[model samples]
Target chain A: MSSLEIKHLFGLRGVSKHDIRLILDHAKQFREILERPVKKVPSLRGMTVVNLFFENSTRTRTSFELAEKRLSADTVNFASSNSSVKKGETLVDTLRNIEAMKIDIVVVRHKGTGVPKFLADNSNAIIVNAGDGAHEHPTQALLDMLTIEEKLGTLEGKNVTIIGDIRHSRVARSNLWGMSTMGAHVTLCGPSTLVPRNTDLMNHVTWEPDIKKAVANADAIIALRLQKERMDDALLPSMREYRNTFGITDELLECAKDKVIIMHPGPINRGVELDSDIADGEHSVILDQVTNGVAVRMAVLFLLAGGRNNENA
Target chain B: MKMRKPSSSEFPIAVLKNAKFWNGKSFELRDEVRLTSGQNGDTIEYDCKGALVLPALFGFGLDFMEPLRDDVYTCADGVDAMLRGGFYGGLYESAANPIDDADKLTAAENRFSSFGCLGSSFDIKFLGAYSKGFGTDSLAEMMELAESDAVAGFGDGNGVIPHSRFLRLAMEYGKMTGKRFFFQPMDKTLRHSGCVHEGAYSDMLGMKGIPRIAETIAAYTVLETARFLQVPVHFKQVTCGETLELVRDARKKGMDVTCDVGLYHLLLDDSCLETLDSAYHILPPIRSAADRDALWQGVVDGTINAISVNHTPVLRQDTVVNFEDSVPGALSLEVALPAIWNKLVAKVGEARAIELLSTAPARLAGSTPVANNVVVFAPDKPHVVVESDFAGHVCNSPLLGAELPSSILAVYINGFWKEL
Candidate 1:
């Protein structure tokens, strides 16, 4: 039990509670380190890591880059927009070219699902999935868990409701699995059109189509960002309709307990998913979630790099 | 290519000493099964016990992705694969070239026939294209292509022509040709980027799901249109149970419609997609287990006409990527027979199982069974599939590394018994 149960952080679907707890405990220590004046560590001093982003992202990539730099590891950033990927180079060729560079770990975000597992199968380096199309994002969910534990003391026996596009949100998928594994009661609330169709994923959580009733007993609420393309895909009628029905506003919050905390995985659509006042309110842990992201990712990269050592041993 | 007359002495004569022969109705153990070449009509006694002899299977939906350049001898490798897999002949759909005219059809036939002269003779009935590349516009040269005697049927090679004004005109025009129109039924709007059946597994794996309604809606339209035109229609690779129900109802109403299910659809379901293995990433995506059961029932109740060996050869690079990005299909020729015999022997009787691959397809294709062509199979023999077992360049068959219960002992092609 001294080391993590899993070597790679692909997703939280089959991940163990012990592994989640271990990552959270290490993130707590990393949190303390970030508050120091130097804000750096030498845990991974001589290692090399690569950030391979096939999609556009500013937040997750920055957090991972900062975490690698803070750990004193050499980092190489590969973005598909300005690289050989645009020259018709396949994913395998791109991975082989990068692998030839002798990196020790890979943090990849791709539009295709199961890409992390694919990279793990094709390469010797340890893998950490940043996000794969509609699939789980483990570190994001871990940061959410860390934020919940920091504010509410413990996730066990807590009522956490996630409202908004549950079908397409990788954060919702990872949080549902990671949170449920830690003994939290999870509720999913959204438009009937946006509910996930997999009964297995829905089995562990409560699905309430009524938003007021869904948040009434919630100890914590995570609001997901609604992608505007959902309208073009005919999954939603209009943005105004989605905002009126599912947006977290003051009047809708009246049914919730006084001690309830609000959260969002950010770059929030200001007037769409969350109101401005509530996002900046005292009860909101949105900024804290962002702060915890760097620490959680640092814990992940450090552990996976060490996991390679465990395998060698 | 000129046909050279093979000497009579080159023919093979074998007398099976106690082997089970499938006589169309049931398996009968014949003490002395003499198989002589049609050319010489000569026979010799031989000791071959514990083997089952069956008529060589005729595949309906065979596709071989011819290499860009033929210096690799992929055509010869594909023919060897077909013979080793117990297929003597099949309808070969030329996927690379749109066979919109008589010249393209003749070109495809010549390409396949030239392979026959390379020591292995396999019959390939080529289908002509009804439309241009991936569009609803009808081919202006369809009438010329339909008039050719070598052309087997008219179809959209890999794309589906949605039931629109184009389809109505095509079918109405097809009545003059007196040929069957083949359709790969699917609603494109319903199948956008979906790689697997829309069910719990797809939702869990977070891959896009191809809904059953995609096939059902399209099949319903095809059947009703065929009824309206009174033209013969054959549906290729029907995957959904709901589509089978529509076919059953159409057949009951005396409509001139027939359908064939892909062999993989009968053997695999959406559960195999759990690993996200590219081998299971196929077109006419594998449906739910319930749909598979319904497909089996269709085969049993005479609702489905034939089980096609949807043999698509994909390069390794096309399948080595992520699941969704991987190309849809694998080289399924060499593994088709063993997969069918092993999976269907217990479910349906052995006789019906062989007919699904052999006589049923021959009857549907309107081809007479060749006198000397047959397959000698060892049912109890176990062989492990390996990379060298596949003669072609690339194959990502799920059967790779599997232990198949039966092995094809030999196939009678080009009037000689070629041993495997």
Candidate 2:
């Protein structure tokens, strides 16, 4: 249960309650980084991080790359090309060849939800999932938690709403767990067909079919991007209709308090789930989420790959 | 069951019978029948008000069909005394399964009366098995949103039920419906990227192994979940006794739960696995004789309630395995009655065998046998055991259709009879 044992964070299933308390305590130490003057720390200095992208991404990938650089760690981004993929080297072989270079940690974004997890299992160094196939985006979620906690000054007793595709958005999936642990009221808003067939699935989340009701009196609303490419035809009626009902327009913004902030895991569609004005406005934390994304990813890389900070190397 | 009087004025004699299963159909209302008890506190008495007369059928067929569909076909027109509004108010009718459509499912699940257990799957990185999370508020909302018309793959068309998410969903459904939902404990379909179980024949034939660990983990996960939630957990058609011992301990801890063994477990063992007889290919991998012995002990000791057919309708080609490579299960329901009657009576007793086969299974399914769908047997009858002779509805038994001692004479479902 020692804070140092947080090195084994992912090894936590069938774990003792006392062990969980230890990980949370360690997390609390990094949790304090949110309040610092220079949020970037060289805890992971001299380490080399490789961002291997098997699928396309901007927000998570760039944020991770920046997070690594900010930590004074060398960052390498190698995306796959159709030519090599078509030439047919198995993904594992492709990764092993890259891994032969002795990178300290691999920040992987793959289309398979467990691809990063699978890599973590096979690799010698730490593996952080920049994005996984619908399974999880742990770092993205922790940072989202950081943003919510900082904006509201406290996560306990806060009402946070996640609007859009709850089913496919790994952001929403991880956020549900993170927010629940921190004791936030998590409300999910999306089309009924899209709101996940298993509501009984999440223990504390309240599903609202109506966006207005979902965001009303909320401390914050997190807008998730629609993966139009990943979805098939008519997953929703249309982008326009999806916006009319579930989207975040200026009218729906009225449902929130004046101090309520808007957040997104970007590269967002300007007119879809959000307005361009909102994305660029004072209340908008879209950009900040991106900025904090780096900080959070830095914290993750440090904890995961840098061995130990505060503790002597 | 005592009648609870809402007030001193009247005691509601709730004859919650499936009357609609007995309209124009004919059934024998037996006035008198023999009474017999098997294994300690379990017994069969002439609960029937009359000799339930029906057709006599002597053969093999694991049937999922309900009894005669043309009966009273009526429900009280009055509003459900419980819920004030809805067409279901006054009277209730009968159907194969209720809460099938989207609209009624909403009302059925979301009401204050329905806290169906909604569940999700839970596991940590590198964890060999997954744990379960149930009864989340989010799941409650999904129940309200997802109109009822959901059956089996009710949630997703793509079968993308995140193992962790599905556990929570099931528990959530249970919480919502105020009903305990049972999950198939053993899922060989989800294994080290392989389907079907591994058997000794696999080793001999150099086949891929589906280790016992997979099934053990599956059971352990369900057991651990029921322990955490302290809710009713049902592990279906358990074939191994080691697992039953766990359930016994869990139940003793005051978890409202139960377990069942499939008919095959009582009849076959890992010896079947040695054939790599594709016919024996099943999920849990029909295990060793020791395992079967243990399973039988579980049944005799009341560690399990009823014997289930696990009546998986599969094609014969599915069972054609090189080693323990055949599909793991066989169609056993139709032959279930005769199989037990042939093998079990000598081990337990005629009465105990029947209880294991009929009365017990009916109760497990919440099927209250009201004079109909009753199996009448002549205990003294003797029959042969030939693998192919055993009629398994889909494909006859791999034992070349074996014939056991007792023959099935009749089955009465409603007020009618159909010769089988």
Candidate 3:
């Protein structure tokens, strides 16, 4: 694969299918490296990576930190809650300070949309958006893609229904772009309030408010976590209504193909977006998605840090 | 010692030779139009060949940050910006500092008079706040303000009065004073906290959506109230198709109502928001392509009375932030005239464009067009809009890099010719 020409992985909005395939190919190698006795690589040695998280996150942050360590790069963790950011230092000031430290890569998860793009435009370091405010979560999408491709062998012509609060899910947006680029027929299902009103603008994507129709004949079904705060905001009437309307149950899965894969980005609200039985069912690839996250992030960091210069040559 | 008045010899008659001006009806080419000498004695002549001269444009509902936030724009900068846009005069909606009472209104009038007395400047009529602090509770001292001769009208400056009852009362009271009430109709409840138009684009961008219902509902409410009060209410910055329909219906029913479309709305739609540039972020946010088409039709069909630059000049730093956090306005004055000519004249015709930009606005503001105060436009002269062209303090122009087809060759104000 030609060297990933992208300087920063902000979002998967305009990322090409060829580039996604290349990243997935590299991630497969990283997944193999995970099974080795010594799970460490000298590919990104001597480079410093900073995880600048303005928003709280456990899974994405840890996954990036582990990826940086596995690639043998020096890592710095900066959480806004404990850092000088609490003192009211502006985002640009804090980022300039970090850039002055000569970090090579900055993994940022900010609560503001377009924060990663802002940092990329202003700073010298490579930016990887961990997750921006309901905008894009490229790494999570890539890991989910890896899990999907692994189970289905290919994403081409596959029916992947992403059901839940898609309006506020950066993961759903990134996956929709990434998977749709790879020739998957993606369906977004939920209440009209949860689904974006402009899904018609997205190619190869359709809205299905009926969960059964969305899951019927699907090769994969990804249930998004319903944000409980949406209830208070009146986006959802109640959790009980949301579950009864759009939640994924075993019976819903039976509407799909015989071996349909079930995926969820972790920290799931068990009964809100998905039934407990369906979350723990045999079709569930939820844990595998978490396991693949490290490899996908490792591949992203490696490629962004000029991975194996000789390999490209 | 008393200063001697300048003699006629010292103040040469400034003549615009071979000029054509839109005479409130059609373009009439004339051999010469002479400007009588003023005290300044700075006189000049212009050979206006193949240029269409029209009444100096009157911009209605323009926001200038002066006396309160002078850092954004002062009266001088506002005048300079308006002159650059071919406007010799405009109504300044007192947005930065709410002119809510007789004292504040007089202060604003005095400030403008003093500033105008300084040098070659434009006439700036102030629009007083409709409600005290625009809080939608107490009515402003409209009678006192009118008696003080401080305001041409009452404006709510891009805000809905929130309470229709209060708005009705304000309009009813304003009716007694013979002052027009200008407002951008919006229901805060329907608007919620959304920034952009509620449609596919907002949904695609994941930004909160401010639905068209927010505007149409408020417009309907305001129209109903206007009908009940039998008072003329001027709606500023109408952005939606349904809002235009409402206005047309009201006008057809012989209701006392007038509405204006933003110049940007005539050319741009919500599709521009796809760029995520905050300059496109505006109140009564740009709607869909259908809405834009309807706005053009409204202008052409005479349903829309005027077009405004809606020039709300903000500091440069204020627009450089995130799309949501950035101030909602654009640096429009420097490019307003040329942009309108380039975008609208072809579809609406030159005569209609002049009526919308000059004649109609002047009539709305209760002013008449004087023959000497005119702008000469070289319609075929194409130039790209750039930051260097702006004399205003703010550089938040949405059309900063756009190539437009019309240029102001010369502008005649008072007895002087401003050549570009």
Clashes of each: 0, 108, 0
Off by over 4 Å in 1: B1-18, B40-47, B67-74, B116-120, B139-149
Best prediction by lDDT: 1
Two-way DockQ contest, 2 vs 3, winner = 3
Taking the true A–B contacts (Cα pairs closer than 8 Å), what share appears in each candidate? 0.65, 0.00, 0.35
- Whose TM-score is greatest here? 1
Candidate 1 per-residue lDDT, tens place, B1-420, comes to: 223232222345666677777777776888886676545555545455758888888887766555343432255666767777777778777566567777767766766666445333666666777777535765536678767655677877768665588888877887788889888888888888788888878777778888888888888888888899998888898997788889888888998888898988988888898787788888889988988999988887877888888887777888899999988876667777777786777777887787788777776666667755777788778888887667656767878888888787766655555566
Best-to-worst DockQ order: 1, 3, 2
For model 2, the chain A TM-score is 0.85
Q: What is the lDDT of residue B357 in candidate 1?
A: 84
Superposed Cα deviation of residue B410, candidate 1 (Å): 1.8
Weakest 10 consecutive residues of candidate 2 chain B by summed lDDT: B119-128
Per-residue C-alpha lDDT of model 3 across residues A111-199, encoded as one tens digit per residue: 76677877887788889999987788999999999999999899999999999999888999899999989998899888887778664
Q: Tens digit of lDDT per residue, candidate 2, span B1-420? A: 111211111111111221212222323333343321111232223232222222121111122111222121111101011111000000011123233344433332233122211100000000001112122123323343232222111221111123555565555454544334454455444444433334433322223445555566677776776567555655656766668878788778887777667667677775554333455655545666777898888877888766655544344443432322233445553345555665675677645655565455444433333332344443445545443332222353554446555544333222111123
lDDT (0 to 1) per candidate? 0.82, 0.52, 0.81
Candidate 2 TM-score, true structure as reference = 0.44
